[model samples]
Target: MQTNNTPQNIAIIGAGASALFVSIILAKKGFHVTLFEKNPKAGKKLLATGNGKCNITNKNLSLNYFFSSNPSFIKYSIENFGYKEFLTLCEEIGLNLVTNENGKTYPASLQASSVVDVLYNEALFLGAKFSFDSKVENIDFKEKAHIISGDKTYKFDKVILATGSIAMEKLGGCSSGYELAEKFGHNIIKPSPSLVQLTSNDKEIHTLSGVKSEANVTLLVDNKPQKTLFGDLLFTNYGVSGNTILDLSREANMAILNFQKVDIVVDIFPTLDKNKLLALLEKKKKILSGKDKNSLLLSLINGKLIPFIYKKAKIDSKKYFIDNLDKKDLQALTYTLKSIKIPIDGSKGFDSAEVVAGGVNVDEVDNKTMESKKQKGLYFCGEVLDVDGACGGYNLHWAWASAFSLASNMK
Candidate 1:
C-alpha cells in the first residue's frame, strides 16, 4: 500500500471493459491511472454487446465455456473473481443486475449505457483520467512506460494493454494490440473472426432464407462430425445465423481458415428419431392423400423450406397423391431431414463477429496476475489475450475476472 503523497503513475491503452475496470480498481488503490482510447468515447463496442443490453457476466462460467491455446489459463482469474464478486461490485456501485434463464447477467435497466456510465463515473470519482482520441502509435518500455501517440509522448510507471481484438473494427477494433504485443516479444496466434455467421454455397439457402427452425446443428470438419449444438437456426439470404451458429463459429472459422472442408449438418427435427419421422411422414401421406406435396409438408416444416427439402430428397413437387410416394421417397425424405449438409465456405467476417478466436498467446502472460511474463511492468487483459468464451456474457465475465486479477497483483 502506498502511503506516500505521490502515487505511482499507470497508463492503460484502450478504454474498453478491461481497461475501465482496472483503472477504477487501481485508482482506488492509490495509483494515478490514465486511459488512452483511440475512439472519442469509451466502451463503444460494449454498448453493442448483448444487442445493446450490455451482458455484464455469466452465472454459468466454467473452463468449458472458454476457448484458448491453454484451456486452463482462465481458471486462476475466473475463480479469483467469480460472478458473485462482480455482482457484489456492481451492487456496491449502485448498478442493478439481473440474470436471465440462460444465466446471462445484465443491468436491471437493460441499457448498455447504464453499465458504462456507472463504471466511468466511479473511475472518474476515484481520480482516474481519460485521454480520448489518443491512439498510442508506438510503445517503448526500456525503462518506464513510454507511449507515443502521433507527435505526443506520455510516460507512466506501468502500462496495461487492453486494446481487445480485431472483431468489430467499426467499434474501434484493430491489429494495433497484436502489433504492440509482437513488438514486446509476445507471439500472437493468427487471429480470425469468431462468433460470426457462416456462409454457405448451397443454392437452397436463398429459398430457405428467413426461415427459422428449432434444430440441432453438427459441425463437420473434413467430412467428419466434430461437434453438435442445438438451438433456433436462422436461415439468412447468405447463410445461417443464430445462437448455435454463433456458438460453433469459433471452431468453424478456424477450420475454414485452415482450408479444411467445413460443413454444417442440421437435424431439423431434433426431438424425432429417424424411425419416428418416417412413421409420421407415412401417417401424413395417408391423412393428406388428396393434398399436394407442398401442402402436405406445411404442417411438418416451414412452407418456404419445403422445396429445398424436396429437391434434396429428389421428390417431385407435382406429386399430389400419397399413392405417388414410394418407399424410396419416404427413405430419402427422412434422410434429408435428419442430415441436411450445408457447405460452409467462410464467415460474414470480423464486422459481424461477436468476438475473435486468437490473440497474444496466453503462455506469454501469467494467468494468476495477468502480467506479461516477458515484461515485468507490462500487463494484458480481456479479449487481447487468447482467451475467448462462448456467447451469452462469457467474454464480458472474462474481462471483469482478468481485470480484477491484474489489479489484485499490481504493486
Candidate 2:
C-alpha cells in the first residue's frame, strides 16, 4: 500500500472483459484508471459472445473446465473469486443475472450489450477514462510504464495487459498483448484455435451437409479413442459442428497441430447399442418386407442419411429390397450407424474460433496478483495469459475472476 498522497495512475490495454472489470475496481479504489481500446467502442467481442446473450459465468466453478500450460497457476484466482463472488459482483453492479439448468448464467435481458453497458457505465461513473481508437502499439517498461499508441506516448505508474487473444480478429483479437509480454521476457505458449468448427476432407460426408442429429461423438487421435461427448452433431459441408463438436474442438485442434491423425466417430443412435440396433433393424426389415430397403429406415433416421448409411454399409439401396436384405446386411448397416468415421483435416481457424487454447505462458506470472515476475508493475489478466476454459461460460468466468484477483492485490 502506498502512503504517499499522490494518486497512482494505472493504464489498462484493451477494453474487453478483464480490462473493463479491472478499471472499475481500480477506479473505485481511488486510482486513476485509463483504458486504451483499438475499437471505436468497448466490448466488441462481448457483443458476440453467447450468441449475443453473453454467458456471464458458470454456476459450476470447476478447475477442470479450465486449461493452461501452467494449469495450477489459475487455481488461486478461480478458487478465490468463484461464481458466488462473481454473482455478488453482478448484483452490486446492478446487472440482473439468470442461470439455466445447465449452469450457464446470463443476464436477465439476454443481451450482451446489457453487460457491456453496465460495466462500462460503472467504470466511467467511478472516474475511469476511455481512450477509444487508441491502440497501444507497444509499451516501454522502466521507472514507469510508457504506452505507445500511434504518435502519442502516455506514461503510467502501472500497466495491465488485457488485450485478450487472437482468436476472433474480426471482433478485435490481436497479437499485441502477446507481443508486449514477449518483450518483457515472458514465454508464450503457441496458440491454437479452440471451440471452432472442424473441417473434414471426406467429400462424401460433405454431401450430408445441413443434417443434424443427437448422438455421441468420440474423438479419435492417432487411431486411439481419446474423448467422447454426447450432444447435437451437425454435418456441415466442411466437416462437423454443434455443441459437442465445439466442446471437443480444443483437443482435436491441438492434436492436429501436433501432426497426429484426428478422426471423429459419430454414433447416430447413441441410445441403442449395436445389438439392440441390429435387432430393431431386423424387426423393421420383417415389417417392411418387399418395400425398398431405403424405406426400412424412413422414419427411423433422417432421409438424407439413409443413402449415406447405405453407401457406408456397402449395400446398394437401389438394388436391395427389404426382402432382399439378409441378416449380414442388417448387421453391416447397424455397424455403420454405430460408427460413422469422419476424418478431421483441420478447423475453421482463428477467425471462427470462440477462444484460443494457449497464450503467454503463465509460469512467469504471479497467479495470485496476476503480476509479471519478470517485470514490476506489469500485470496480465484474461485470455492474454496462457489460460483458457472449456465452453459454456467458463472463459468469461475466467476473465472476471482473474481481473478480480488482480484488482484486489493492486494496492
Residues 246-316, candidate 2, lDDT per residue (tens digit)? 99999999999999999999999999999999999998888887898899889889999999998999986
Model 1 lowest lDDT segment of ten: 290-299
Highest-lDDT candidate: 2
Candidate 1 lDDT score relative to the true structure: 0.89
Q: What TM-score does candidate 2 reach?
A: 0.98
Task: Write down the lDDT of every candidate, Cα atoms only.
Answer: 0.89, 0.93
Q: Quick one: RMSD of model 2?
A: 1.1
Candidate 2: stretches off by over 4 Å? 1-3
| Model 1 C-alpha lDDT per residue in residues 1-411, reported as the tens digit of each score | 566788899999999999999998888789999999999999999888889898888988877898898988888988888888998888887989999998999999999999899999999999989999999988898778898997999888888999999998999889899999898899999888988898988877856889999999999999999999999799998989999999999999998889999999999989999999999989888888876677657878888888788889888767766668887898899999999999999999998888999999999998887889888788999999998999989999988899999987887
